[model samples]
Target: MFRPLAVVLLLVSTEPAAAAGLDAASINDAAPPSVKLPGPHQVNASVARLEIMLDRAHFSPGEIDGKLGENARKAMIAFAGANGLSFDKAVTADLWSKLAASSDGAAIVNYTIAEADVKGPFLEKLPPKMESMKDLPALGYRSPREALAEKFHMSEELLQALNPGQKFDKAGDTIAVANVLDAGNPAPVARVEVDKTRQTLSTFDAAGKLVAFYPATVGSAEKPTPSGTLKVTAINKNPTYRYNPDYKFKGVKSKRPFTIKPGPNNPVGSMWINLSAEGYGIHGTPDPAKVSKAESHGCVRLTNWDAGRVAAGLAKGTPVTFVESAR
Candidate 1:
């Protein structure tokens, strides 16, 4: 059946790391380190700043979580390449200076929660099964914190870690958040490329210059992505998902066709870019953390914000090339 994309769960730590300088002041003032350090992912001020900078430059680092994870590394590498810098999995000093020079702003800023942020007809709990979601009024966020975290392109864990003891349900409560809301609109895209090997999507201008880059999740082994060239047919915002029984997706036992309502938590997230290939398109996912780390059933998957940004710069008949190797 034409099922909604699979959702992957990611576990993140919410423990506050005051000793590691995870506060707003430290994050805002953090400068890039001259040398790359080897260690496990942890709550780090410098990494947080670097993520914010890369995100602001339109090379999204996926959900900013104060760690130099794979998504962040991919964004850094793409940004380095686009800027004509040599980066070999290490955050070089030259790359850091270039990123800082391009995206000039504080990494973290204080934001007052608005009434609309808490006034949600939020679901108390979202059903795990897709069939169970058909009867729900809307697949909205489960909590105010989830809504706020997605609004600022941050992980829920990072949001909690940044503002400890502060429940996000209260309106007017000021909290520290990543400064990623003002990335600005990218230039019109002339073409799009999805590299399966690198798990990245890049939009290019008419002159063949990179305009924006995003980490994406291509198709999995069971359902490999389409090869060769395709064209964009349509773009839908807050798309309603319709299921067909022929696909017979795993974990879905229903033999009949079904339809799910639209929301950020919907199987397709907030945006859907229909492709020439039937039932195979580039769409957004509910789990931003799994954008590139996880597998997709067949179509390409990007973060909700990244999908929207790409949609804005694209029109009907835009060329979309899918390749197994990096270009």
Candidate 2:
């Protein structure tokens, strides 16, 4: 349960890009989860900083909302795969120590494998390769299956049939990337319909089209998501989150809550498309698979990629219809 050293105050400086040193106060400023009832996901300043670092490395965490959505986690793993770091979403001490030590960390695009790309001893070392999916090792991959999963920010299970037993760091192999768009025609946007009983979000498009679908975490059965047809209110890019203490929960309540700035760690990822349904809207997340399965205070949850597409495509006042689906 140990968190990384926070260096997010650096986020405030108008010249974050120009500053060259890491600050300790930023690391210590992250509020403990136990005190604030941290959401199922870790959205805070420190995680946001990590997202920025990953993006700088050319491993995009997709919107860098301080909330580690599936893209951020996967990007981190991809970076790890390329650089030989562990792929777990939880930041390790080694990763933290490195992040803390480095003034200007590596960017994601910096690790592209080219014959021209120089190879050092650190770069030469890599994970083993697997002959097939069944050949995957204990770490679940002999090659970069998991690594590639993080690269495109997708679930490893989705790529199982393609490359099995690949080490995350293995070079010169074709790893399956996520099918971002469907075969034939790709949809411009995805619409999420919240099902109270199933607690899932069904993705659709502007033409009343059904594109993709998944389960969703909704407002608790008790809180119950407010039902209504709404429109896109506003789109906030890389928004900072303001945690409200007055908000009530089914089991717990907070007297004083803290507001966190936007980054990969914020509960809301890089983009937030507010809906006409008062506080409810569709937004990006750190975890992709967890989208429909987990609980949101009430808002619709989507992967940063999915959300960004939706947010970017639609304008404020875009009609967003919400209907109660079968439980």
Candidate 3:
């Protein structure tokens, strides 16, 4: 069943709380100051640096918001486990050193806004309902800020906090952004694992070594995810979302089928890895922050960039196994 993609809409706060003590210099510092774990979701240079490093290492912290949120914490633990280090919800010096050593280069870098970035037949506003989206010409980003934020795997609020008073619509404008461009191609994925309990997706190489880890949003109670093994059938980029009446997704009143145009804001985001299961696939999401934090209808949801990476390393017959507990 192709159920409606449930998302916790991001309410961008007007307050500049995420901008506190956040500067390009601090974020680019070689030795970032230690950050306390289980802290509030406040913008801190240390957390930003950690997120960038983890992202570069292919252990995505999901929408680098410059905070030690649940996604970030999960990434840290997974990275530590892969590196033979013990982590217990704390960022010890050794763990920080290991993470820093795993990837080189500054976390934050300056990026000049380009003409293509600002030039958009941008949407003035997007309707909250899925049925209303089918009529639009293209479901492109609502604004340049949103486009840029997704470009660098950053939260819209974090991008704005990094460049206060600077409008993202202007070209030739240099601004601080997360340096999470391309982390390079990973090893060929021999198998893919989705742990529903942990809300994580991991790719393993032929030798059974963990290649990449990502926080994921699995299915909800109303529409639980499928169990057992599945295989990758196809990979689609910039995929259009088709809604079926059989899904009967909440908030969607339409009984007929419809298709939503392809764009970053598209319900399926940028990439879709079709699985052997009829209506189940591991796909990208428009809401990166909600990954692993929200419940999906049935499919496995990942950050758009993370999904792209996973798709790049996947093959047509690669096995995808879903489990309730860690294997």
- Residue 315, model 2: lDDT of 62
What TM-score does each of the candidates earn? 0.92, 0.45, 0.91
**Global CA lDDT of candidate 2, please?**
0.46
Better of 1 and 2 by lDDT: 1
Candidate 3 per-residue lDDT over residues 151-201, each given as its tens digit: 999998889888888779999999999987857867899999998888899
Query: Residues 1-327, candidate 1, lDDT per residue (tens digit)?
Result: 011111111222223443434688877776665344523356677777888898889998888888767787778777877887766535667888898887867888899999999999899998998999999888898999999998898988889888888889999899999988877879999999998888889999999999898889999887789999999999999999888878677778999999999999899999999999989889898889888888887889998988988999999999999987623
Expressed as tens digits, the lDDT of each residue in 51-131 for candidate 2 is 545543434454433443544554544455444555343456666555434325321111333232122122112222111
Runs in model 3 deviating more than 4 A are 1-20, 30-38
lDDT of every predicted structure (CA atoms)? 0.83, 0.46, 0.82
Q: In candidate 2, residue 45 scores what lDDT? A: 47
Candidate 1 minimal-lDDT segment of 10 residues: 1-10
Candidate 3: give its CA RMSD in angstroms. Answer: 5.8
Off by over 4 Å in 2: 1-153, 156-176, 179-193, 197-214, 249-254
Ranking of all candidate structures by their TM-score, best first? 1, 3, 2
